[model samples]
Target: MTRIFPRPLTAAFAATAALSLAACAYNETLGRNQFLIVDDAALTQQSDAAWAEALRTQPTSRDAAANERVRRVGGRIVQAAGLTNRSWDYAVFVSNSPNAFVLPSGKIGVTTGLLGLVRNDDQLAAVLGHEVGHVVARHAAERYSTTALSSVAISGVQSVAGDYAKAAGAIGGLGAQLGVLLPFSRNHELEADRLGVDYMQRAGYRPSESIALWRIMAGQRQGSTPEFASTHPSDASRIAALEQYIASQGWS
Candidate 1:
């Protein structure tokens, strides 16, 4: 039976290859191929549900100005990204962390701290543009596909290990961590940065403010987990990349 179970590993690889054959598609905007097992329809449905859950559970800001600012800036970025066909919702969460996120379903949530951090509309546009870029790049679907592949690979290993898999709590834990908690690659971050500035510029937001925003973000950073272990590029690296990209565009 152990021998038989080991054969499932081979079957698993075959399954992965089969999955990849149909899932690999070229994204012209990103200028690359993405491995995506989930289609937009399904992804949007899932994201809508998640967005609803977040709005329901999270403490949201009622500050009219903050809410209006995010919506106003976000609208321009989404339009620039050519993603305005969908109904987009923006909310400000009452949190100290200066962060924002965009759902695949065209929902955006920003922290009040982020509102307080930006010096002007252009800087806020920079952050919103980056989040919009992630959506236009179809990063959420790509991330889901990668996580699914990780699970498939982990299952394959467990099959080969047979009874030993039951004894490997550490391996199981690592699999969960890799499957869920791992951040997007630095390449993804850089790509998003470039795409963001493109949208910012197209929307008539000063491209140079994007650089300034990152510099401000870098200065505000006190400490973070090492870059190797983080899902984001180091602040210095991200800022430098943004600077290089903005210069390449000749945007002052």
Candidate 2:
């Protein structure tokens, strides 16, 4: 039996496949290939919207000192990353969780708890550098491209099925979050960590303090998800890797 795809559907599939193939490009900075179907303009627009939504929905800190500190440190990291071409904006969220994130659109959010946790400027630079590394490495675009390609592939499967099912059903809520709106893969995290230390050291910050910051975070007895289950490396493994990378670079 011969099954024929509709002309429009066949065209769509061809386009999708072409996009997938064309998206694989080598990133010189990351020393790897990245799947980036979406262009920077689209990602930046989405990031801008996401940053605005975060600011409107989340409780942000009004502390002058905290805001200034994040901005000051973030500025140095961005410069070190050679990403000063974009206008970077910083915001401190009023959260107890020690967390921070950077959008590709040059928006950074740091929690108040993170500000309080860091013992010095170097440690703060470490955190900011990690976030900046994500932007530099273009992890968000890669994740979005991978998820979009998966969704397209699943849609092709649906076209052949007797009854169409939502792609969301094929990929559950958790999978969707992981593919779209969550932390990066463990590999991405490690790459970010390495790039972060590079930027930190280049910016005249102590590369070793980055490891210390992670140690302090590991010691915090907080009820949270484990690293094994999350898209982040274990604290121990992360520290070890950072130490090795620092030693290889001879940055002390």
Candidate 3:
């Protein structure tokens, strides 16, 4: 039996395959190979939209001091991360649950609850550093690229045949949900935690405070999802990792 693919589809597949191969680039910063098919422009646009939507739908804090504090601290972290290329924006969302998020577009959203939770500037720096680390590490971009590539491959295969039911492309990629708020992989969280401490240390903040912040978070989430089942790493595991990394760097 002979199977034939349309010439256009064949050409498309060949071109995409070549592009994918070319996109497998080594990021010295991350010390890993990344498959990046989507360009930055698309990511920036999506991120901007997400930021805007969040602001529109959510209630923002009218507290000027809170906004200033986030901007002041976030600026230091950004500078320390050597990501001063773009203008960064900060917003204070009025919520009781302590939370913060960063967008690749350099926009940051922090709940007023988070501001109240931080005991000192160093603790605040730790949180900002972690978010900034995610940006510098390009974790969101990497995740998006992985999901996009998986989807393309799956769609391409599905377009082909009924005979190839055995072709399993389902790796459970998050389809089209490109929000910045999505929880990163456990490895991503750990890497971000490491990078967060690095930035805060360089920014003249105490790196040990990073561990302290995680401890506080752990205390607050006393009985949440189990570590194995959660998207983010367990707070204890994260604190231990941060402690080890900070000690290894000889930074408090």
Candidate 4:
């Protein structure tokens, strides 16, 4: 019934409360409570499948040395994060675009472009540590939960607003982005940056190189999206935050 659907933001807040206690978990590492309907096991399973698909479809390099280098640096990072419970796999993908990613399944994929871009192992560790932080922080699960709840909220808005439903739904969606989704994404990146430096320091890598790595990435990206609309923080913002954090930790 039309009457059954509550106002968009109202439904979102109401559901968020009910989803608490069970769904809202406090992460001591992050020092925040997260709304997570999904678990790490589920994320790992999904990532494992995606890793398989990527390996099958992507042009993976047979370069033995490159693969070993990734394994070496990644192994240290995993150890530093105390996430050595799972077996970690590393692969080099033949791509010119400087990029890297880590799956929740402890699988890491690095582009040859990224390998060529890094000036040293410390820089590589900085990059890899950031990806590992995403895994350790369970950012994927939190993002999934937020998206699922936001969709339900938008649908409620559409069902209840009648003639104005489309407009109401748009407003609700935008509200979710500005108030919840985008902020969470940007915070996640910043958190990962901080965590990455922590791991780099623990792994005996120079924490300063993380800043250097990000600066190079900034040079590669000409004009960036504004911080408010963008998911990731701008390079300048990220660098400034990292500098502040590294200094607070008394790391050069």
Clashes per prediction? 0, 0, 0, 0
lDDT, residue 154, model 2: 59
Candidate 1, residue 10: Cα displacement in angstroms equals 1.2
Q: Give lDDT tens digits, candidate 2, residues 65-154.
A: 889889888888899999988899999999999999988889999999999899999999999999999988988888778778767765
**Candidate 2 local Cα displacement, residue 218, angstroms:** 1.5
**Where does model 3 exceed 4 Å of error?**
1-20, 156-184
Model 4 lDDT at residue 145: 89
What tens-digit string does per-residue lDDT give for candidate 1 at 1-252? 354445687888789889888899999999999999997667888888998999899999989988988888888898899987899999999999999998888889999999899999999998999888888888888888877876787777777675798555457657556444454566677788889899989999998898889888888988887876777888889888888888887887
Off by over 4 Å in 1: 1-6, 166-184
Question: For model 1, what is the error of residue 108's alpha carbon versus the real structure, in angstroms, after optimal superposition?
Answer: 0.3
lDDT of 1: 0.84
Name the regions of candidate 2 deviating beyond 4 angstroms: 1-17, 161-184, 221-228
Error of 2 at 9 (Å): 11
- Which lDDT value does model 4 have at 18? 80
Indicate which candidate wins on lDDT.
Answer: 4
| Full ranking by TM-score | 4, 1, 2, 3
* Predictions: Cα RMSD each: 3.2, 3.7, 4.6, 3.1
lDDT of 4 at 162: 80
The RMSD (Cα, Å) of candidate 4 is 3.1
List the candidates ranked by lDDT, beginning with the highest: 4, 2, 1, 3
Task: Estimate the TM-score for candidate 3.
Answer: 0.82
Candidate 4 is scored at a TM of: 0.92
